[model samples]
Target chain A: MAALGFGLAYAGFLGLCLAMDRHHAELLRGRPAAGRRWLLRGVGWLLLGLSLLPCLALWGVGIGIVAWLGLLTVAAYSLVHLIPYAPRLALWLGPLLPLAGLALSLAPT
Target chain B: MKQGFRQCMAWLHTWSGLLVGWILFAVFLTGTASYFRGEISDWMRPELHAPAAGGEPAILAIETLKRLAPDSPTWFVFPPGERNSELRVVWRNPPGKPTPPGSRGFGNMVLDPATGEPVTARESYGGEFFYRFHFQLHMPPLWGRWVVGFCAMMMLVAIISGVITHRRIFADFFTFRPGKGAGRSWLDAHNALAVLALPYHLMITYTGLITLMLMYMPWGVQAVYKGDRGGFQAEVFGVAPPVRRANQPAPLAPVGPLLEEAMRRWGGPPGRIEVQQPGDASAIIRLTRRDSEQISSNPQTLTFDGVRGTLLGASGEPGAAAATRGVAYGLHLGRFASPLVRALFVLSGLAGTAMVATGLVLWAAKQRHRHARAGRAGFGLRLVEALNLGTIAGLPTAMLGYFWANRLLPLHLADRADWEVYCFFLLWGLAALQALFWPGLRSWATQFAAAALLGLLLPVLNLLTTHRHLGVSLPAGDWAMAGTDLLVAAFGLLLGLLSWRLFRRAGRAPVTRPVRGAGLARAEGA
Candidate 1:
C-alpha cells in the first residue's frame, strides 16, 4: 500500500512536469499543445488526490496525511533528479512504477 | 517597490543563512544521525550480542536496581524495547550524600536482559554523543542550547525570506542543471534541495525551537506562575510532588504484578519505571507509557503505592495546549514513527543537510567568482571559504574518527569515553589548521579524501577488531550491526566520488564566467 502511494505520487508529479513547457520540450521533444497541457494538468491533480487513498488506508487519518506529504516530497525530488539526467527514463518509470506497485499489492504474503 | 522589497529580503536571507551556516550544518548532520542513536548504541556494545532473552526485562531490571541502589531515593529503569536491547537503569543519590566515584549524584548501568548482569562492554558514549551534540554542540548545556536556539531562529528567517525572494519557485520546481557552470549549478542544487523538502525544513526548525522553548522564552511561565517555574511544570506536566522518605525501611513489593497491571491498563508496554523512595514506607512507583505508542512525547504515567503495590492514580489526558506542544515535540523527535516513516524522515533530514551544504558552497563559489573578476580574493571571501571547507568536510572526518577511536581505544584506558571525544576534536582541529594554511581546492580534496578513507575503512576495522563484523552479523540477522557497516561504507563511497571530482577539478585552471541568470540568482540569494 505504501509503495502504491509512492508510485501514484511519482506518476502524478510526472504528469505535472509533462504539462510544463520546458520539461515537456525536454522529455517529449516538442512543446505541449494547449489542450494536451490542460489534460495533463487535470490528470496530474487527480492522480495526486488519488494517492491519498492508499495512505489513508495504510496509516490512520492523522499520520496518513503526514505520510502523504512526505511521499510527495520524495516523489517530486526523485522526479527532479531523474528528469535532469534521464528524461526519457524518468517518463517511462512513471507508468511502470504504478504497475509494479499494483503487481506487488496483489501478490500473496 | 516589489523588486526593492525582494532585494532586501534576498540580502536578509543571505546573511542570516551565511552567518551561522557552519553551525547549522553540524547540527543538522548530527541530528539526522540521532534518528538511529539506539541502533548506533547497540552496535557499539558488541559484548551483548546474544538475541533477546526469554526473561521479562522489567523483572530483571527491578532485581538489578534493587541490589545496586538499595538506599537511593529514586530509581529509573528503562527496560529493553524495540530500539534498544539493553535494560538500562539510573538512580539518584540521597540528598547531601557524597556521590560515588565516576558519578555526579547519579549512577547508571547497562544490564544484559538475558542474565540480568552488567554488560562489561568497553566504556564509550556511543550514539548519545551525537544526540547530545545535535542540539548542545558539546558546550555547557545552557550555552550550547542557547547558541543552537539562536541559529534555529536565523534558519527560520532565512527560510521565509528565501521563499519571498525566489520568484520562479514553481516554474523552476523540477529544474536542476548540474552541467551548468559552478555558480549556476550550485544555485540550482541548493534551490532544488531547499524547495523539495521545504515542509520538513519548516517543521524541524519550528519544533526544534519548541523543544527548548522554556529556556528561550520563559516570559510566559514567569507571567503565569509568578516565576515559580517548578510549580508551572508540575501543573502543566502532571508531575506529582515528591514523596518524602518515611525513615522506616520497608521491603519493596514485587514489581512483576504491577508491571502486568500497567500493561493491561495501557494496552502497551511501559517505557520507563520510576520508583521514588524505593526502600521506605512512602515509596511510590510510576510507570510511563512508551514513546512509540503515541505521537506525543509527553508521559502518561500511572502511579502506585510502592510498599503496598496498589494503584494510586493515573495522569489525565493533557490539555489542548499541552497536547499540541507534545505533538510538536514528538514530531521533531520522530520516536513514534515506524521504520518506513523513519526512513522518509532520514531522507528529508539528508536533503536539509545538503541544502545547507550547497548554500554555503554557493556563497563561496559566487564570492570566488566575483573575486576572480576583481583580480584577487579579499580577506572576507577567503575567511568564508576556509570556514566552509573546514566545517563541511572536516566535521564528517572528525565524526568518523570518533567511531574509529571507539574500536581502537584500549578497554582499560582511564576516562575512555572522554578520550574518544577528544580524538574527535583533535582531528577537527587538525583539519581546521590545514584549511587555515591552505584554503584552496586542493585542501578541500585532501579533507574529503581523508573523510572517504576513514569512512570506508571503518567496516574493515570492525572486522579486524571485533567479532561482530558483517560476516557474523549478516548471517545472524543482526541488522543493527550490518546496517551501520553498510551505511558507513556507502557514505564513504559518496565522499570518495566527491573527493575524486574535487581532485580532477583542482588539476585544471580556475574558470570565471559571468554567471547566467546572475540577476535572478542574486535576487534569490542562492
Candidate 2:
C-alpha cells in the first residue's frame, strides 16, 4: 500500500514537471503542444490528487502527507537523472508507472 | 556589511555551512542511523536473535522484577515489540533519596521472554553509541549538548541563508549534471539535494533546535517558574513533581489491576510503570502509555495510589503551546512513525547528510580550481580535501570496525563497551591520517574502498563468529537479522561502486577551465 502511494505520488510529480515548458523541451521532442500541455496538466493534477487516496487509506492523514512528499522527491530525483540519456523512458514513466504500482499493490502479499 | 541581502545570505550560507559542515555531516549521518537504533542494537547483540513472540509482556516484566528488584522503589520495562525482541527491565531507587544531585541509581538487564532468563548479550554500546555521539560527540553530557546546540544554530542559519541565496530553487531541483566539472558537479549535487528535500531539511533542523531550546533559550521557563526547571516540566507536561517519601511501611497493591485500569482509561497499552515509594503508604503508581501510539511523542501518564489501587486522577491535558512543542519534538524524534514512514525519514536524513557533504566538497573543489589557476592547490584546499575524505568515508569505516570489534573481542575483556568505542575512534583517526597523506582523489577512493571491503565482509564475519548468517536468518524468517545483513552488503556494494566511479572520474582529465555554454554559466559563477 505504501509502495503504491509512493509510486503514484512520484509519477504524478514527474507528470507535472514534464508538463512544464522547460522540462518538456529538454526531455521530449520540442515543446509540449498546447492541447498536450493541458492534457498533461489535467492528468498530472488528477494523478497527484488521486495519489492521496492510497496513502490516506494506508497510513492516515498526518503520515500520508509526509510519505507522499517523500515519494514525490524520490520520483522527481530519479526522473531528473533519467532525462539526460533515457528521455523516452522518463517520458513514459510518468503515465505508466502508477498503473503498474497499483496492480502490484492490489496483488496479495 | 554593505552587501545586498542575497549577497549577505550567500556569504552567511557559505561560511556558516563550511565552518560547521564537518560536524553537521557527522551529526546528520549518525542521526540518520539512529532512526534504526533499535534494529541496529538488535544486530549488535546477535545472541538475542529470538523471534518476537505473543506472550504477555507485562506478566513477564513482573516476573523479572520480582526476581531482580522486588523492593526497589521504581521500575521501567521496555516490552518486546514487532522489531524489538528483548524484554528490558530497569529498577531504580526513589527520588529524594539521592546519592548525588541529578544522579539516577538504577540497574538494568535484558531478558528472554520465553524463559525469563537474563540474556547476556555482548557488552557493547551498539546503536546507542551513534545516537549518543550525534548530540554528545562523546563529550561530557553538558558540554556535548551545548556544542551540539551551537552547531544546530549554525545549521538552521545555513538552511535559511541557503534558501535565500538560491535564485532559481525550483529550477535547480530538476538539474544535476554529474559528469560536469568537479566544482559544477558538487554544486549541482548540493543544490539538488538541498532543494529536493527542502521541507524536510528545514523541519528537521528547526525541530532539532527546538528539542534543545529549553537549554538554549531558558528565559521563558526561568521567568515563569523562577528558575525551577522541574516545576516548568511538571506544569508544561501536567505531571506531578516528586514527593517526599512517607517512610511508613504498608503492603503494596498488585500492579496488574492498575496497569489494566490505566490501559482501559487511556485506550492504549501501558509502556512503563513507576512505583514511587513502592513499600510505603505514600506509594504512587504511574502508568505511562507508549509514545509510539500517539501523534504527540509525550507519553501520557495516569497516577494511582499504590496501596489501594485507587485513581489519583490523570495529568491535565497540555495547553496549545506545550502540545505544539510536543508534536514538534515528536516529528523530530519520529518515534511515532511506522516502519515505512521511519524508512522515509532515514532517506530524507541521508539526503540531508549528502547535502552537507556535497556542500563541503563544492567548497574544496572551487578552492582547488582557484588554487590550480595559481599553480599549486594550496594548504587550505588540501586541508579541506583531507578533512572531507576523513569525515565522509572515515566515520562509516569506524562504525563497521566497531561492529567487527564486538564479535572479535573476548567477552571477558574489562570495560568491553569502552573498548568497542575506543576501536571506533582509533580506526577513524587512522583513516584521517591516511587521508592527510593521500589527499584528494586517492584519499576519497582508498577510504571508500576500505569501507566497502569491511561492509562487504560484515555478514561473512557475522556468520563465522555466530552461526546466524543471512542463509540461516532469511530461511528462518528472521527479517531483522536478514535485513541487516542484506542492507550492509548493499551499502558495501554502493561504496564499491562510488569508489570505482571516483577512481575513473579522477583518471579523466581534470577540467581546469570552466566550459563556456548556455546552462553552464551558473556553474562558472558559483
Candidate 3:
C-alpha cells in the first residue's frame, strides 16, 4: 500500500514537473504548449488526489493523512534528485513501481 | 521598504542559522539515529540472540523481580515486546537498606523471558546515549536541555526568516547544481535540502520545543498549580497517587491473567508494569498501554489491586488540552509510526542535518573569498571554520568510536559504560584539537577519512570480538545485528566519497573566483 502511494505521488510530481518550462525543456527536449501545460497540471493534481486512497485504506483517516504527506515528500525528493541525472529512469519507475506494488499485494504471503 | 524588510529577514536568517548550526547538526544526526535505538541496543547486547519466548513475559518478569528485590517498594517491569527481546525490570531499594553499588538506589537487570534468567551482556549505554544526547547533549540534565532548547528556538526563527528571505522558493524548488562554483553550489544544495523537507523541519522544530515547554516556560504551570508541580503532573498525565504499604505480608496474585485481561482491553500488550508495594496487602499494579498501539504519548493505564488481582480503575481519555499536547509529543517521538513511516522520518532528519551542514559551509565559503581578497583570514572566520570542521566531521567519528569501545572493552571492566562515553569524547576532542591547528580543506579531508575508516572497520571489529557478526546474523535472520553493520558500512562509503572529493579539490589549483561583494550577493540571493 505504501509503495502504491509512493508510485502515484512520483508519477503525479513527474506530471507537474513536465508542465514547468525548465524541466519540460530539459526532459522532453521541447517547450510544452499552453494547452499541454494546463492538461499536465490538471492530471498531476488529479493523480496526487488519487494517491490518497491507498494511504487512507492502509491507515485510518488521522494517521493516513500524515503518512500521505510523508510519502509525498519522499516521492518529490526522489523525483528532484533523479530528474537531473536519470530522467528516463525517473519516468520509467513511475509506472513500474505501481505495477510491482500491485503484484506484491496480490501475491500469497 | 519591501526590499529593506527582506534584507532584514536575510540578516536574521543568516545569523540565527549560523549561531546554532553546529549543535543543530549534531542534534539532527543523533536524533535520526535514535529512530533505530532499540535495534542498535539489541545489536550491542549480542549474548541475547534468541527471539522473545511464547510464555507470558509479565509472569516471568514478576517471578524474577520477586526473587531479586522482594522487599523493594516499587518495581518497573518492561516485558519483551516488538522493540526489545528481553524482559527488563528495575526495582527501587526499600528504606533503611544500603543501595546497591553503581545502581543509584535501584536494582535493574535484563532477563531472558524464556527461562527467567539474567542475560550477562557487557555494560554499555548503546543507543540510549544517542537518544539522550539528542535532546540533552551529554551535559548536566538541566543545562543540556536549556542549551538544546535555545538552539531549537533559534532554528525555528531561522526557518521562518529563511522562507521570508528567499526570493524564488518555488522557482528554485527542484534546482540543484552541484558542479557549479562553490558559492552557487552550496547555496543550491542548502536550499534544496531545506525546501525538500520543509514540512518535516517545521513540524520537528515546533514539536521539539513543545517536548520541553515546561522547562522553557514554567510560568503557566506555576501560575496554575501555585508551585504544586506534582498535582499538575498527576492531573495532566493521569498518574495515580502513591499507595502506602500495609506492612502485613501477603502472596501476590498471579500476573499472567491480569496481563491477559489488560491486553484484551487495550488490543495490544502493555509496555510497562508498575508494581507498588509488591507482596504487601496494599499492593497496586498499574499496566501502561504500549506506545506503538496509539498516536498519543499519554499512556492509558489500568490499575489492579495486586493482592486480589481485581481491577481498581482505568485512566480515562485525556482532556482537550492534554490530548493536543499528547499528539504533539507523539508526533515528535514518532513511536507510533510503522517501519516505512519511520524510514521517512529518518530521511527527513538526514536532510535537515545536511541542510545545516551546507548552510554552515556556505557561510565559510562566502567569508573565505572576502578574507582572501583582504590578504588574511580574520579570527572570527577562522574560528567558525574550525568549529564547523570539528563538528561536521568530528561528531560522527566520536559516535563510531563509542560503538568500537562497546566491542573492544572487556566485559568485567568496572564502569564500562562510562568508559565508552569517555572514549567518544576523547576521539571528538582529538578531532577538535587537530582542526584548531589546521582549519583547512586538508583537515576536513583528514577527519572525514578517519571517520570513514572507523565506520568501515566496525563490522570487522564486531566479527573479531563477537559471534553476532553479519556472517552469522544475516543467515539467522537477525536484522538488528546485520542492519547495524550494513548501515555503518554504507555511511562509511558516503564519508569516503566526501573525503575523496575534498582531497581532490584541495589538490587542484586554489579556485579563487572574483568577489563581487560576496557577502552582499549572498544576502540578496538568500
Candidate 4:
C-alpha cells in the first residue's frame, strides 16, 4: 500500500510539474500555457492527496503521515530529475503511475 | 573582511564541515549500521541460532530466574522482540551491596528460552559497539558524548551554512554530471545528496542534539529539576521505582499471570519485564509495552505487586513537554519504524555519510588543483588527502577486520570482545599509516581493494568458521544471517567497483581546473 502511495504521489507531482509553462513547453512540444494547466494542477493535487489513502490504510495515522511525507519527498525529487533525460517516459509516467498504484493497492496483502 | 553574507556562510560551511568531517563520517557510518543493530548482534552470535520455542516467554523467564538467581535483589528479563532470537536476563545486587572493584554492578547472560539454558555465544561487542560508537566513540562516557555533541553542533552549522552557500541549490538539483573533472563531480554529488535529503539531514541533526539535550544544554533542566536528575527521569518516564527491599523472605509469584495481565492492560505483549526485590516482601514487577505499537519512544509500562500478582498501578502518562521530547527521541532512534522505513533511514544516513565524504574530497581536490598549477601540492592538501583516504576507506576496512577477528580468533580467548575492538583500531591505525606513507591514487586503490576483499569474502569466512553460509541460511529462512552476508557482499562489490575506477584513473595526471572566488582552490586538480 505504501509503495502504491509513493507511486501515485510521484506521478501526481510529475503531472503538476508538466502542467507548468516551462515543463510543458520543454517536454510536450506545446506552448507552456496551452495545455490544461489548471486542470493538470487540480488533478495532480487530487492524486497526491489520494495517495495518502494507501499509506493510511497500511499504517495508522501518525506513522502513515510520516511515511507518506518521506515517499512524497523521494518521488518528487526523482520525478524532477527524471524529466530531463526521458521526457517522453516522464510524460507517460504521469498517467500510468496511478493505474499501477491502483493495481498494487487492490492486490491481496 | 568585507565579504557578502552568502560568501561568509560558504567559508563557514567549508571550514566547519571539513574540520569535523572525518569524525562525522565515522559517526554517520556506524550510526547507519546501528539501524539493524539487533540483527547485527544476532549475526555475530551464531551459536544462538536455536529456533523459537513458541511457548510463553514469561513462564520461561520465571523458570530461568528461579534456577539462576533465586536470591538476587533484582532480576531483569528481556524477551526476544520481532528481530532478536535470544532471551536476556540480568541480576543486580541491591543498593550498597559490596562489589568487586571493576564489576559492572550486575551480571547478565543470553539464554535459550526453550531449554532455559545460558547461551554459550562467543564474547564479542556485536552491534552494541557500533551503536555506542555513533555517539560515544568508545571513549570515556562523558567525554565521548561531549565530543559527539560538539560534532553534532558543527554538523547543524554546516547544514545551515551549506544551504546558504549553495545559491543555486534548487537550480543545481537537476545538474549532476558525474564524469566531469574531480572537483565539479564531487561538488555535484555532494550537492545532489545534501539537497535531495535536505529535510532528513536537518531533522536528524537537530534531533540528535535533542537526544542528548540534557548533557549539551543542562541549564534549563538543572534549573527546573533543581539538579535532581533522578527526579527528572522519574517524572519524564513515570516509573515509580521500588523502595528498599525488605529483609523478610518471600517467594515470587508466577510471572506468567502478571505478564498476561500486563498484555491485557496494554493491549499488546509486554516488551520487557523488570523484577525489583525479587525475594523480598516488597517485590514489584514492571512490564513495558513494545515500541512498535506507538510513535513515541517511551514505552507505557504497568507495575504489579510481585507477591500476589495484583496491579499496583501504571506509570504516569507523559505530559506535553515530555511527549514532545519523546517524539524527538523516537524520530532520531526510529525504533518504531517498520522494516521498509528503517531501511530508508539507513539510506538517509548513508547519504549523509556520502555528503561528508564528498565535501572533504572536494576541499582536497580544489586545493590540489590550485597547488598543482604551481607545480607542487602543499602539506595541508597532502594531509587532507591521507586523512580522507584513511577514514573514508579505512573505517569500512576496519569494520571488515572486526568481523574477521570474530570468526578467526580463538573462541575461548579471555577478553575476546576487547581483542575484537583492538583489532578494529589496529587495522584502522595501519590504514592511516599506509595512507600517510603511500599518499595518492595508488593508496586509495590499495585501501579500497583491501576493504573490498574483506567485505566480499566475509560470507565465505563465516561459512568456513561456522558452516553457516548464504547457501544454507537463505534456504533455511535464516534471513538475519543471510541478509548480513548479502549486504556485506554488496558493500564489497561497491568497493571493488570503486577500486577499479581509482585504478583506471590513477594513470592520468591531476586534472587542474581554474580557481574561482577568493582563490579557494576548491576545484579538482587530479
Candidate 5:
C-alpha cells in the first residue's frame, strides 16, 4: 500500500519534474519554443496533486513513493548520462531525482 | 560586521561549515548507523543474537534491578522493548564522586531472554558510544555536551547565514553540475543539498541546539534559582523529579506492579523504570510510557510515594514548556515517529552525507582549477589538499580500527571498549600522519582501500574470531548479525569502487573549463 502511494505520487512527481527541467533548460539556453510550454506546466501541476496529500501524511506510503521516485530518477539520470540525444531525460527527470531523494529519506528504512 | 549582510553571511557560512564539516560528517555517518546500533551491538556480540521476547522485559527489569541495585541511592533502568534488546540497569552509589555518576555506574546486559540467564554479550560499548559521542564526543562528559550544544548553535547560525549569502535562492533551484572545476560544484552541492530540505536542516539544527539549551544558557536557571540545578529543573520543565531524603529505612517497594500500572495507563510497554532509591526510606517510583496519543508521547511518569509505593497524582509538564521542549527534541530525533519516518530521516541523513562529500570535493576542485590557471598550486593549497584527504579518509579508517579492537580485545581486559574507541582516535591520528608524509594520491588510495578492506571483511573477521557466521545467523533471524555483515559488504563494495574510481580519475588530465551547465550556473557571475 505504501509502495502504491509512493509510486502514484512519484509518477506525477516525475512528470512534473520533466516539465520543470525543460522550463529550466529553455531559460538557461536562452528561449523555449512556443507550443511546448503547456506540456510541462500541466504535467508539473498534476504531479503536485499526486504528491500533495501523501507528503503531508508523511507515512510509509509517502516515503515509499519518494524512494521509488529516487530509483526512477536514478534510472532516468543514468539514461541521460549513458544515452546521448536523451537530453529530454534531464529536462524531465533532473529535478525529481534530488527532490525524490530528499522525500524518500523522510522515513527510516 | 562592517560588510553588507550578504558578505558577512558568506564569511560566516564558509568558516562555520568548513570548521565543523569533518566532525559533522562523522556525526551524520555514525548517527545514520545508530539506527541499527542495537543490531550492530547484536552482531558484534554473537552469543546473545536472538530477538528477545518483549513480553518478559518488565520481568527482566525487575529481576535485574533486584539483583544489581538492592541498596543504591537511585535507580535508572532502561526497560527493554521493541527498540533495544539489552536489559540495562543504572544506579548512583556515591561518596567519592559527588556529582552525577554519569558513565560510571553498575551496568549489566541480560544475555538471553529465553533462559533468563546472564549471557556473555561481549562487552561492546559500540552502539551507544556513537550516540553519546554524537553530541558530547569523548571530552569531559558534561563539558563535552555543552561543546556540542554550542556547535549546534553555531550550525544554526551557519545555516541561516548560508541562506542569506546565496542571493539567487529561488532562481538557481535544482542546480548541480557534476565534474565541474571543484569549487563551483562544491557550491552547487552545498546549495542543492542545503536547500533541498532547508526546513529539515534548520529544524534539526535548531532543535539540536534547543535540546541542550539548558546547558548553553545555564545562567537562566543559575541566576533565577541561585545555582539550584534541581530546583531549576523542577521549575522550568518538570521532567527530572526532586530528590527526597528518607530518615527511616524501609524495604524497597515492588516495581513490577508500578510498571504494570503505567503500561496499563500508557498502552504500550513501560519503556523505562525510574526509582528514586533502590532500597531506601525515601524511594519514589516513576513508571512511564504505556500508551499515549501520537501527538505527545512524553514519558508520562506515574509517580509513587517513597515509603508506601502509593500512587501519586499524575503531575508535571510546566504549562506546555516541557512538552514543547520534548516535541521539538522528539521530532528532531525521530524517536516519536513511526518506523517509516525514521527510515526517511536515515535516507535524508545519507543524502546529507553525500551532500557534504560533494561539497568538500567541489571546494577542492575549485581550488585546484584556480591554482592550475595561476600556473602554480602553492604551499597553502597543497596543505589544504592534504588536510582534506587526511580527515575525510582518516575518520573511517579509525572507525574500522575501533570495530576490530572490539572483537580482538579480551573480554577480561579492563576498559576494553574505551580502548577500542581510543584506537579509533589513535588510528585517525596515524592517518593524519600518513597524509602528511605521503601528501598525494597514493596515500588517499591506500588508506581508502585499507578502510574498505577492513569494513568489507568485518563479518569474516567476526566469523573467524567467534562462532558467529552467516549460515547460523540468517536462519535464526539474527538480523543484527546478518545486517552487520551486509552493511560491511556494502561498505567494502563502495570503498572498493571508490578506490578504483579514484585511480581512474587520477589518471585523467585536469579540465580547465568550469563544469557548470545543466542549470548549475544560475547564480554565479560569469
Candidate 6:
C-alpha cells in the first residue's frame, strides 16, 4: 500500500513539476497562453487528486478501473486531436504517460 | 537510383520489419508470458505446488539448502516472490555429469519441497525458455541471438520510418469502425494503439536494441582489446566475480546462513546464486535479490567469499553499471515490479500485438488499390500478402493447437511436454504453408476455424485424457487448470465467430493474387 501510494505520489509530483516547468517556460518566453496554463493547472490538480486517492482504501478498485479507462481514453483523444504533428503530440503525452500508467495501476482490483 | 535512397531505406525498413513482425509478435507474447515463469511452473507442476510458502523462508531455506546441495559449489534458493510462491533451489553440475530424465532446466535442479530431493516436475523449461527464446529463439546460441537482434534492429528502423510514413496518425485514432472495410478498421486500430502508446513503442524498441547492442556491434570491442567474450562479459556485466582456482579444493560455504542473512537484510530471499570456479582456487557465492515489485529495476546481489564467507561488495548499490543492467533487465522482465505494473505490462503487450496486427492489415488494405492497378503484381506482392495473412491469422491457430497438443499427447510419453511445444511451431509452419497455397479468404476462414475447433475441443480433449475439465475444475475453484481450459474455450468460441464472418466474407468475393511463394520467411515462431 505504501509502495502504491509513493509511486502514485511521485508520479503525480513529476507530472506537476513538468507541467509547471513547461508552463513557466512559456511565460518566461513571453508566450503566455492563458488557455494552456489553465490546461496545465487542470492536469496538476488531476494528478494531485489521483495521488491522494490511493490513501482511500475502499474506492481504490473502482477508481483504478476508471483511471485505466480515463488514461487510455485521454491518450486516444490526445492522439486523435493532434493532427499531422505526431512529434508534438508525443512530446506532450510522453512524460504524462508514466504518470498515466502509474496512477492507473494504483487503483485496487 | 539516387532519387530512391529515401524510398529504398523505407522499403528496406518496411520489408525487413514485415518479414519479422509476426515472429516478433510471438516473441513478445511468449516473453511476456514468462514474467510469471515461476507461477507458470507451479501451475504446470501441480504436485510441487506449495501454499505460496506460508512460513518464514528461513527454516525452509536452511532445511532445503542443507538437504539439497551441501556438496555443490553454491546452493541457491529463489524463495518465492509477490506473484509466485514455492521455493526453488539450484545447483550446478558439469556438462558431462549424468542428468536425470525429466529435468526441465539445464545445469540446475529444482528440489521437491516435500523431501528436498532433486525431482522432476512435468517438463517445463517454463518461462525461462520463452525468455531465452524471445531474443534468439532456441536456435544454436549466439547465431540465434544475432538473427533476433538483427530483426529487432529492423523493427527499430521500421518504427521510425513508420512514424515518418503515417500522415494521418492522429486523425485515425479512435476511428476503428467494426464491420467497416478490414483495411479501414485495421488502420484505426493501428493508429490508435501505436500513436497512443508511441513512447512505449519507442522505449521498448530502443531498450530492446540496447539490450543486445554489444552483440550486434562487436567490432568496437574487437578493436579495443583482445576478443575474449567472457572477459568482456565480466567487465561489462561486472556482476560475476573473476574466476579463481580454489587451491587445495576447499569445501564451500553453507547457503542457509547467507540466505537467512540476505532475507533478513532485504526482506526477501535471493532469487539466484552464482558459484565462481566450482571447485577451483577462488570460489565465491553470490545471492541475488528478486527485486521489489516497483516499476524501477534493482535486484541487489550480495557476493561472499565461498570458503571463508567473507562479505564481498553488494552488486546493486546504485552507482555501478551492474546496477544499471539490473534495472534494465528488471524493466524488460517486468516481473520484479508489483502485480499492477505487471498487469499494465500485459495490457500494453496485448495492445502492442494488436497494434502490429492492425498495422499489417492496414498496409494490406492501403495496397489493395495499388495492387489492383498494377496488373504486373508478381510473387513479391503476393508473397507479402500471404505472409501478412499467415502471421495475422495463423500464429493463433498454431498456439491453440499447442494447448490442444498438451491435452491430446499421451501423458506418459517420454519427452512429451517439450514435443508438444515443438508441435506448436510445426503446426504453425504448416499453417504458413496453408496460407500460401489457399486463397487468402479461405486461409483466414480455415485457420480461424482450426483455432476455434482446436481451442473449443481442447477442454473435451483434457476430459478424455486427464478426466479434468472446466465444469468440475471451476466448481472446485481449481483456477489454474480450469481457468486455462475455460479461457481456451472462450477464445475458441470467439475464433468460431470470426471464422463465420470470414467464411461469409469469402463467399462474397473471388479475391485473386499471384501464386504464393511459401512465405515462411516472416513466420518467426517465438
Q: lDDT by residue for model 5 over A22-54, one digit each (tens)?
A: 434533343444444467557655654554355
Residue-level lDDT of model 2, residues B185-235, one tens digit each, is 678888888988888898888988898898889998888888999888877
From the highest DockQ down, the ranking of the candidates is 1, 3, 2, 4, 5, 6
How would you encode candidate 6's per-residue C-alpha lDDT over B1-526 as one tens digit per residue?
6446657665775676677877777766666556556554544554454434344453455466545544454445665554553566666553455767755333454655444555555665444555676787778878888878787777778888777666555334334444445355555667777766665566566667767777788787787766777776656545663554545676667666777878787786666666665444477877777655333355467888877777887754455565566556555655534444455566666667767776665555655545555544466666666777777677778766766665566667787768877887898788888777763566777888988999788778767666445666668656556655775688689889989977776666544452442121111100
lDDT (tens digit, per residue) of candidate 1 on B152-193? 999999999999999999999999887576488899999999
Best by TM-score: 1
Q: Which of 2 and 3 is ahead in DockQ?
A: 3
- Per-residue alpha-carbon lDDT of candidate 5 for residues B1-526, written as tens digits (9 for 90 to 100): 5457779888887778766676677666666666666666666666664655454655565566667556566777665445555666666664354443445654445535544456766667767776777787778879878767766766777778888888877555545564555366567666767666565567667877777777777787777788888776665545656566665678777666776677677666666677776567777877666321343444566788756778976756546777777667665565533555555566666666665565555555565665555655667556665666677778778877777888888887886767878788899899988777665555666788989988888878877887767777678766667777877778777888877756555445343332211111111211
TM-score of chain A of each: 0.97, 0.83, 0.92, 0.88, 0.34, 0.38
Docking class of 3: medium
Indicate the docking level reached by candidate 5: incorrect
Pick the winner on TM-score between candidates 2 and 6.
Answer: 2
Which segments of model 3 are wrong by more than 4 Å?
A106-108, B52-54, B100-104, B511-526
- What's the candidate order when arranged by decreasing lDDT? 1, 3, 4, 2, 5, 6
Prediction-by-prediction clash tally: 0, 0, 0, 5, 26, 11
Per-residue lDDT of candidate 2, residues A1-109 (tens digit)? 7667766776776777777888888877588888998888788778778887887887788767776777766766777778776878887876677878888898988
Q: Which runs in model 4 stand beyond 4 Å of their true positions?
A: A12-50, A76-97, B1-3, B95-101, B507-526
lDDT of 3 by residue, A19-76 (tens): 8899888888899999999999898888899889988998888678778888888888
Worst 10-residue stretch by lDDT in candidate 2 chain B? B514-523
Say which prediction, candidate 4 or candidate 5, comes out ahead on lDDT.
4
Q: Kindly give the stretch of ten consecutive residues in candidate 4 chain B with the minimal lDDT sum.
A: B514-523
The TM-scores of all predictions, comma-separated, are 0.95, 0.91, 0.94, 0.91, 0.81, 0.73
DockQ of each: 0.77, 0.56, 0.63, 0.35, 0.14, 0.11
lDDT of each: 0.86, 0.78, 0.85, 0.81, 0.62, 0.60
